[model samples]
Target chain A: MEVSGGAPKSKVKVGIPRALHFYRYFPFWKKLLEELGAEIVLSTPTSKKIVEEGVQMGFGELCIPMKVFYGHVLHLIENHPDLDYLFVPRYVAEDKDAYFCPKFLSLPDVIRILPNVPKMLNFEVNVKEFPISQSVIELGKQLGVGQSRALESYKTAKEYFKEYQDFLRKGVPVNHALRLVQRDLPFTVPKKKSKGDIKFLLLGHGYNVCDTYINLDFQKKLRDQGIEVITIENLPESLFKVPVIVNKRLRNYWRHEEEIMQAIRYYLTKGRDEIDGVIFLISFACGPDSLISELIMRDMKVVGIPFLDIIMDEHSGEAGLLTRIESFTEMIRRKKRKLEMDAKKKVKSKIKSEV
Target chain B: MVQVSDKTDGSKAEKEAFLGIDVGSVSCKFVLIDIDGNLLTHVFLRNRGSPIDSVKDGMAKLKEAVQENEELQSYTIKACGTTGSARYLTKAIVGGDLAKTEIIAHAVATQSMYPNVRTILEIGGQDSKIIILRDGIIIDFAMNSVCAAGTGSFLDHQASRLGIAIEEFGDYAVKSNNPLSIAGRCTVFAESDMIHKQNAGHSREDIIAGLCDSLVRNYLNNITKGKDLDEPVVFQGGVSYNQGIVEAFERHLGCKVEVPKYNVLMGALGMAILVRDHYIDNETETLFRGLDVSEQEFKTSTFNCGDCPNNCEIVQVKMPSDENKVIARWGSRCGKWEVF
Candidate 1:
């Protein structure tokens, strides 16, 4: 209300907490905001100090991820005092049938109760009844931007977002993909380097899997060991089509849950040989991920493909996690070795009969 | 046995034996196996809160045992492998050929004896694991998470509280006609229930028997939930020494559960088997430091790394024989101080 949202003089500063769906939608938000002439600020990546402060400030009832978001919010509020507004979007439903967790739908109001908070830029994202542009226009009106101009910026941002997704489908990591897209560099897919003979499909929420401090850089650790670590976002989104994943009898109404199940189920059936094992990371902080992981575990069990479910709460001991992962890879290696030997044996017998 | 450089004397044949050390939270084991898979010496020692001491002491006993044997003269440790909670630490101290997880080691040991083993229930000192195998390969495994109900430490505590030695627990539990229902969801709840049963005029045998039943139920319901427990089921680890718990597993699965002869030393045996099988065709010299490590002094020190806010505790171990140089460093979350 005190200034023009687009002007360079006293430019509006919008703070985005680095948690939750930040990994998924940050690039799109940054593109749209930059086009609309607003500056953006982000909380730093999660650290030990931030996590401890978050746990102290957060109540016992809130889940670990909620506590993490609280820490990021506090970081943004305390670190960036010149912030004009905090962008906490109310994400309800991504599709016609799927909705987000209640925390995402309700956390904006919850943060409002915190003392001495900056003004919040609350936007609704419900793709079921409206397109994302409709939601953007409503937010644009609040920011004192013309609807037509906001619509134009939205279209351009949409293209940028699609390109980013294209990079993801090509197996470029999210961080590198974001950099390539944000810098508006010449488009070229990075060549795929085959590391390990084995592939592991890592399934988890984007926030849990992408947060390095939360998971102790587990994916990279696996990659260093020559195991090609992949996530749902790394593959084509078309794998989650209604015909491929959803049936009337078996469907998950949660958008994130549906993605996780679809990715795992894809590996279990059509892409069974694409991966040697599956590692589902579950944050004990969130109940839904655990429930969905159990369902995925059963499918992996029936197929006899190796599957390991690791749980992380406020803090997890690395020793236990290391042991489980080590043994799991060992099991897969032995199984592969035995299969090759058996195949060789069969071929040799056939050759003997021909001779 | 005739492969030694000078084989004229059978006693001086330099019998090739693999050394396998398993250092868990509650106990440590040292095993020696000849090339034929015959166990020469198996030593199980209580950890007593320090696995370093257990390893040092266990090695001493193994050396004395080997020297005392009349047939295995001119003894030489060909290769060494480590498994269990402190496997990495043990490897650093013992100069092991490889460090493998207890799950893999246990699975290998069981399938070597019973090739068709489908399920393996291992209740050790601080952890309990259930491994599912098919066609002699490990498929699925789960460790007891978030509780110590099925572990040996809790059972030992309960036995001491009831004034009964853990080794004789089976004798008392077998006499119970009606076992009391002890809580098995957690150690805290189980301890309180044990006290209440003592006050409620329940016999000691009944309480002990009830505790074993409760532990098996908790393991199946929590850790191995919905896991298939097929035939040729082998039970190993320290808990297999207790007849009551073994019988409880047999009853719970409604199948015959076989406990191998070296049940307590299966992890060590498995590691020995693994290293031997892996190096069977290779000519590479072993990295084993030999049994002299037991006579040498091991110096360990822990200091908080003040580099960051995390203040990770970095532990470093120095071998006095190696000019008192640091051998291994651990306990840093960032892996900056990792030396092994």
Candidate 2:
């Protein structure tokens, strides 16, 4: 395979699975690994057989994403044996503004339980507590890369990562005229507009939106109605400004909640002008979404912004949803019409007074 | 009132109805029964959006059915009962009735249908549970909701992946003789295994049948573990319609599994029957807010309840037409918000 920069082959190779947080942070890992003169091999989109082997390896009760990660690991061991070290970074939290669930924090420990594999290398990174230089040195030594080489690669990788991230931070142009702003991207994508169309913002965790069957064609129904749906996953992590004092003390804290809140706060401040309404799609038993959604919706209601809270579970119903969506949409449409009519009337009156 | 002894009389009372609502994570069912314990109207709708909206629509459908039936309108509803995940929210919406667990409702309904029901295997849209019964009483039960493979949702997901409608899953199951050994312990493994089987040149039908088999196997291993499952086993819930699963259970258990006529609505039916029995002795006002309640807006909010360290966040849904009333309260981790 031809390397991007035409660099010579490296002695050490690392395997990364393009799943879960990998979907969110592949570019960062790629640049970092390359700068450190290490070969990076990422598994393909999880195929059926790989997922099966993964399931067999990762024992009982692990979530699908974790299983997918395990599947990728199994694929690496089976297909590619040239790896010097299998690097699985141990990420607990990014900052006070960003945190991951206990599931992610314990992933390395869980993966270690699998039968047998190459030398496992893990680097713990948490900006709030750990020093980046120390973590990089530890990671380098584990991978058989000397301190000098590892330190230089770390600096280069961090710089390149920041540069690439900047591109994502600012809005990207979808076409010549339209811009796809990530910060206000709704969870649900809108249907193609004809003449007049309504738009709605859908907020929730990525897992909920990505799991289509569980959510029951939430996007399809909205598209059927020619409504534009927005979600949080579309937003760039950089565009989202962390809230002041965005720390929590809950034992079971949802890592994504703060980011969701940050994105929502940005959208509520700016999205109110661009979007017609917002809908918070929360899970039935998820404690964090319940609290965060309530807090956000309460604030929205006070501002006279129309917001709807949808709690989804395994038994989501069709007729009830249709009726509710119809009602909520009808309310929003009527309100918009009323506002337009009132504005038109005021303009006509002003024209008559000038005459 | 006919002067008769309670034991002698079948206690046939007219002009009073009972409402039973099952608010499942995947679906919501409403059943209205007359004092005679006859099923008058039933509303089964998919909970595609919100439980509150779905339940309200189900209530509206029930109202329409009642309006068309003269016998249903003649009697006032004596009581209302709810079951399932959203039972508390449903109870608050319907008001003033017994709120029972899904296990109790399922058992009660199954027992009423087949007096000799030994094992009750119920798989709904998103979750699955096995209730072992001895002499018409639940001895031990196990349920798993966090994962998808052990439930009907897994089938729905795999069906969509195969580009087959959920209704057609059973027909494909019948056609496949050489089924692949697909894993169904969790959604991830099952999905991965399905892809691998498909890639390995297995027909979709064979893979689907394999999946059906694995689902049944997982259910047996996780739910019916160490239980004395015997003859006359009954299958209930939406998953029972999947012929693949039903046949799978029969094939695995080596016995015919009986599915009742009202298997899908059995829980709702059971709750309605319970309500009828609760109000059999005395006349009481039903907590049902009438048919017009469907048109009213419900304002829902959640606040961290400062009462304890659990901070047990309480979700409050205030019904319209009441200035100083909170119709429903839920979302308490400690069951504190479940106000009857």
Candidate 3:
């Protein structure tokens, strides 16, 4: 598949392991790599065999997602033996307060230690420390591309990435947004509808929430229960623009944690009436989540909003999770009924007194 | 029974009742409640790895009890709800109108009885949990399903190992004046520590008390590490009946731990209440298949679908009366085979 953009003399085969930030940033990397005249090869989706292999091959203490990442790397190596380079970016920081998890920052180094792994092409994308454009130019230099051609491709990729983010903000799930970007389809936001009887905001990282296999298709389960499911990504940009942490002590240093905390704060303060409950879905053994979830739990308690924290791992059973979600929705529905009854009682009392 | 007698007599009245069943890994519990949330009767049985048999036995006993009681005979089971680990399995078996998690079920039951309760400590056969509440609404909760160090089964194994009756294990611990400190981080370590204490000539009472203390400590450190444990704290589930653990929790938290009369059956009670409320709100006929399900023979089978790279292992439950029809299907990633 050749395009009109300045084509390389020979098409370079680029291997992209389908794990970790791939769920979130695959569009940007894919568009950029294809524009640079490269063929993208992705590892297969995670499965039982992949998880077992990952568990056997990886450190016992490493989180399940990280282990799954290793399995994908192995898959890519086994399947695409002739690939020129494996693009494993060193994602240091995305926002000022939102830093990548320690595992993410050290992912490239971790994969490099694996035996017989192919050569990796990496660029430092620490928005806090350096410019992304500079990283792109450096990456292009390593890929043997001209400066002007690389710069143009980077601009096009950035635009596509921005559109992808916009779609996420408009409530399009990550996987669907990636598909839209890959197919060059026009971006259309799902029309907003009246909120259902019960609404819950699911807070978690994009990978844990979007991966159906990893989370056991939690979204579908919630939808089946006739409850509206909303994610942090569904919130508008304005909700995230204002700083939620007024207390200096509670200010989070991690980039994603800050975003999550901000969205939670927005829901508790401004969106309280619109939301019935908040469910925090975190991967087991996630260091950042272990700390951040505690903070969110404390804050949720103070706000008096119902909250449920579900930890998902390879061993997470589907029945247990469903029961929890079902009960939570039922409890919310009961609370709503009581509130309506109280309101009606007050109205009846007022009418009686007037009469 | 006292709570049931307190309600006004409806001698000639045809009252509606809701049924709740909690089928966990180690036990099965059933509760019957009236519309006003008065517990009519409850039964708890050890599952012994056969939830279907336990549920069927519980149902048969409940049916017999209802038939024997004049007041209960007039009460119609309008709705049914199921909860716990085998919620889906039991829900299918009973044709339940609603299915919920044990967490919600316990929280609802506690909130109904003690509106001001801020904390709930539930320890079942295989799992333990700490649920934080505010204004009768569950605010935060955590369960230790991954570990066995703090669950009821661990205590049962230790009791059996010590040649003491599980029922009398708590009394022995309560008799101890000076409880020794035993390692409680892992079950195997704790078991070894108990043996060492015994070999060192420590009294059985002290060792048992120490075991209880260790389990409580492990629970606080792991499941409820950062949770807010405000009072009034209500402890329930099978472990709540163990006075030794209750004392250990009370001593550690420096607060009173209230154990409800139907502590072990709280999940079933909560589910019944949920179904009662659900029926009232929706005003639709319940999907209950009736107590006759106890006599039916159900079958389950699973196969891996090869249509895609996902290869999801789809589980199908065949209904008893209808042999050819699949009552429910799960474990499919794409929702293609999910008949329910």
Candidate 4:
């Protein structure tokens, strides 16, 4: 319905490419779009065909996630021809003093290269220049809503966005979190980890790491090995408040780098006992991640914690990934077992001496 | 007194053994170890690119080796372990109690022989790994990426290009007095550097020696970079046979690199030890399909499942003798058909 008069709402079909920022910021945008009389159309979950199409269509220099994101756009264009508009947002900066990757800055331009693409409902998100509220109201106006209603929609969506984050803060899976937050449902506490279950602090970007296809079902594979995977996204936001090692070369140069840098520092020091090992997953050829992963590896090594660095690319074979992960888990198990045996020997020797 | 592996009483002297099969990218090995953890018989055979056929050949050789020893003729395999690139496939073929990764196997074998080993450099066919250990615990490890720069296959390619037998490749390295310098970053660049040295009038022996040094340099710079390597560094794997690389590593690190007795077969050896300890501790019945598995017939094929857009190529193995009973099915993202 119209806010200015009794005109009927069009129920405009807006296509959302389920990638990149989809893992983090999709909730707010989805809520904002749906409440503004537009039906949301999400691209399918990532599959091998999508990845293969992306790898073939994408340029060699682009990272794996970018290729995957491009694949999602092509998928929406080709599969859902009924889509009236494609919602490809341009992410310049989420915070002050740090910017998104250049890939994010040019996402909309890159996707528009394909022929016969839908009209883009592009939302330029640069909080430094103007508030996110302004961008939301602008996007809502594109969907044919009044400014007052758009501001209310933005406020309501902001609350839903926080609900989404709260679910993630409780260690819910990204997909489940989105579904739950949409329905306004409660998230149950995850099952308690057993005594023998190994805890692995998995570190990576939300998009690449959480995407099962990109990381080769990384979290599921870890659970298969009787391991409990804890990502930086699963931890509370307060964990990033401390003064870490803070080396200038290893500081939060990128916007999301703060989470990774801070997570490693916490695990290596105060929260060392919270996990048994660290598995860092990185996209091959990612500029910021290349440096971040090296620092993570070095920090873990210095503390003598068992660590594994899995570099994922388009052709990341499942066999190699499984082998590395299995070996790391086995190593932690044997190391703990050996320490127990040595402790038992010391007690036995002390008892013999007392006798 | 060999720690967890030799929990069995060696003095009892029972005719029982554990079997281990390692199917590598270029070769396969089968070994039998007694309860005392001593190598009873070992058969290292080039699989000729087919792991299944190689396992059959290895079994025949193992049987022949056992026939020569009167005391080992009636030995029973209490446990069996499989490892290497085709570990899961080999485990499915021969029916193994467990399938462990190569890194863990190498570390276990090295630690058993030299319990104080702080660093281990293992270079096998198609793979090379640097493992850093502290007090019998592996703290960090790095495996060669999708590159073949400093692996056994890389050296094998060069050795053939220079008209030298793979076995004699190392002897030439030791004979050369003046080894030329070559880049060790990429296989293509390393090959080009070798050609350049050859055109520049370097001796074959010197170039071969230089290749060995380049491989060692690659390992130190790429694989073991930023990691601490303490004393008692253990070097093993198929590549350890190259005394040239051994000398190169020793010279670069300024410390002695000890090659274990079963350097070429450590993966199989550690697997056997792991299987043995696990069998004894758990008291579970051995999953080995018995000695007749060598004679069993199997059919292995891969087909893409058109169930969805993923089109995953699933590997299916069946026992031909048992009315095509599906023995193992894997290589699928979603494990609906997987038995292993």
Better of 1 and 3 by TM-score: 1
Query: How far is B7's C-alpha from truth in model 4 (Å)?
Result: 24
How does candidate 2 fare on TM-score? Answer: 0.48
Query: How much TM-score does chain B earn in each model?
Result: 0.93, 0.89, 0.93, 0.93
- Strongest candidate by DockQ: 4
* Single-chain TM-score of chain A, each candidate: 0.92, 0.67, 0.91, 0.92
Q: Mind listing the fnat for each candidate?
A: 0.64, 0.00, 0.53, 0.72
Candidate 1, residue B155: CA error in Å? Answer: 0.5
Question: How many residue pairs collide in each prediction?
Answer: 1, 24, 3, 0
Full-model lDDT, candidate 4: 0.83
Can you rank all candidates by DockQ, best first?
4, 1, 3, 2
Which ranges of candidate 2 are over 4 A from the true structure?
A: A1-355, B1-14, B305-312, B332-340
lDDT of 2 by residue, B1-340 (tens): 2111221233453456678899887888888777776777888988967778887788778778777776665556668888877776788776747766676678778888788887889999877777666555454455653455668777787889999999999889889989888877777998998998888888989988998999999888866655568777999999999899999999999999998888789878878887677677554645666655578788888898776433546778886678847877765534556664
TM-score per candidate: 0.94, 0.48, 0.89, 0.94
Question: lDDT tens string, model 1, A175-294?
Answer: 666556556675577787876889898888878888877887788768766788888899887777843344468766788888887777777778888889999888876767877777
Measured by TM-score, how close is model 3 to the native structure? 0.89
- Report per-candidate DockQ: 0.66, 0.02, 0.46, 0.70
Best by TM-score: 4
B155-229 per-residue lDDT for model 3 (tens digits): 889899999999999999999999999999999999999999999999999999999999999999988886779
Looking at candidate 4, what is the lDDT of residue B36? 77
- Give the DockQ-based CAPRI class for model 4: medium
